[model samples]
Target: MATWPNAAIATLMETCGEAVSNAAWNAILNIVFPCPTYLVAPEQRLDSSRPDLTVYIVGENGVFFPFEGKPAKFSWEKLGGEVLGYCIAARPDAFQGYNYGMGGNGPECIICEYDGANMRYLYIHEGELCQSDKMHVLHIFRDAAEILNVLEFVRGAHV
Candidate 1:
């Protein structure tokens, strides 16, 4: 049976009538992650760069998730660099989580890259930008159900 992520992707393709674009992905994310307390903004500027989507968890010390979406043909290395730059420039605190001799709290940010057919989740910890071993590739066609569960878990929601 098709899972939630696959179902969502199918619905998006039907709605878009073409390969899903960054804007379409942002809209789909809003639907999947609906909330009155969280804000999902598309095409938001981060320093001199613009991320495809920026999700802000509302409240004191709100968190931000920077997402980059591209066509399936795009190169992930190039896209990852761009997203990394945005994260570094707009949310440097995310990279300081494991800094030496630091005691103050640093923001934890998850950098997401989606290329229509696949999704990759990355993070900056201990001065290294690394992909989660558990969630390196979330293939829309092959791993849709797991993708939905992983996303919820990443967002700290019970699955």
Candidate 2:
């Protein structure tokens, strides 16, 4: 539940000191938190290539949420293959992308155990359901809340 003027989001893009993808993620996180927040990259290996940043959302009891940032792309199936790597990481569970208007259906997230073998899955609902341009800012919040809800569900179930 954070609000940033459209101008601010543009300003963030204009003055980014990191990769476009990472900068987008950082800007969103900045809006989410009041103080300076730094995302810790997950510590795990995936098919030789991983995302630009892996953010950690650790609950009070040590449950970790791996938030991986991905650029919006056209290929959903291909992206799914790449996302499999995140599910394979050495972490409790994982979530990818910041809900930037990358509207077309693609791999949204991978939440799994850190055992290095067992993997569970959660697919973010496509943004197509919401009527608008695929990359609009408002849609980001709507989808992000859904992602967070799923994460909380997984946490509550003790999965």
Candidate 3:
């Protein structure tokens, strides 16, 4: 794992882009994950077409949550494919828990399981079914104390 001592919001903007959504993710992550975070930009080109980001904590815990920060409409079938892409590109090996799910080729969303983490892509559907696609990232906590610590961090940040 690469060490990022200068894991600041400015560094993330330099590496990622100047977008509110990216910034939101960074802020949220900085609050959620106590570990210093950094944005992993794609090589050679500089554009926000694809977002590559990863957060690292001490020891053998890391998570790659690459997201296409945009808004779009999708049907259940299209959403399933997109969710598959997100989960497949997540690189679960970086996290402690690693599991994923596929909706058995059904018209629903393809479920992805990471370790003990589970999320439904159909969360962004509509009305009673509308839900945001599962956000991919590491939410690591060794114990209740750590969870409280994270909560405090978020509360302090007011994110």
Candidate 4:
């Protein structure tokens, strides 16, 4: 919709540490959704917790998507809870919601789906959880296309 080439997403995936990653992701996040048609609260609070952002359309009421990002030194143990918190707090209620979220750790990132009825999620794990139990993670170096595919899917799905 924005015609912002998905290939350009490579710039974001290439960032290294926390500050660089956060700023880079923030710039893309601001431009990706654009304006007039969308209302994005970049790096702002969504109720009680905060992700890197909260986003929703201009006329939407009580609906928002929370997004997060991390440096190369990332941990699902800490970030997972935060992402889930953002998802749980921001989801559209009354009828139903997508309950979807995405996060990045430097170039490595994952899209998350939360099944509220089932209380299930696959994007969270730490040393306590068995390595095999964790879902396969996508590395920027190895899964660039896959990552871009997912972003394209997001653009096509909603826009």
* Best candidate, TM-score: 4
- lDDT digits (tens) for residues 100-126 of candidate 1: 000000111124533233335644435
Best-matching candidate per lDDT: 4
Write candidate 2's Cα lDDT for 1-159 as tens digits: 565334444344334433553555544444442333323343333346545444444442321333444444435454444444544542433323212211112222333332343333443456322222122222233356654444444444333
Model 4 spans > 4 angstroms off: 1-16, 27-32, 93-96, 118-133, 140-142, 152-159
Q: What is the lDDT of residue 22 in candidate 1?
A: 52
- Would you give me the overall lDDT of model 1? 0.45
In model 2, where do residues sit more than 4 Å from their true spots? Answer: 1-18, 27-39, 42-48, 57-68, 92-139, 154-159
What order do you get sorting by lDDT, best first?
Answer: 4, 1, 2, 3
Instruction: State TM-scores per candidate.
Output: 0.57, 0.42, 0.35, 0.66
Regions of candidate 1 where Cα sits further than 4 Å from its true position: 1-19, 60-63, 90-135, 157-159
Instruction: Write candidate 4's Cα lDDT for 101-152 as tens digits.
Output: 6676776666655546422333323312112224346564455455445544
Error of 2 at 82 (Å): 1.4
CA lDDT for candidate 3:
0.34
- Candidate 4 versus truth, CA RMSD in Å, comes to 6.7
Candidates' RMSD to native: 10.4, 8.6, 12.7, 6.7
CA lDDT of each candidate? 0.45, 0.38, 0.34, 0.56
Query: Could you tally the backbone clashes for each prediction?
Result: 0, 0, 18, 0
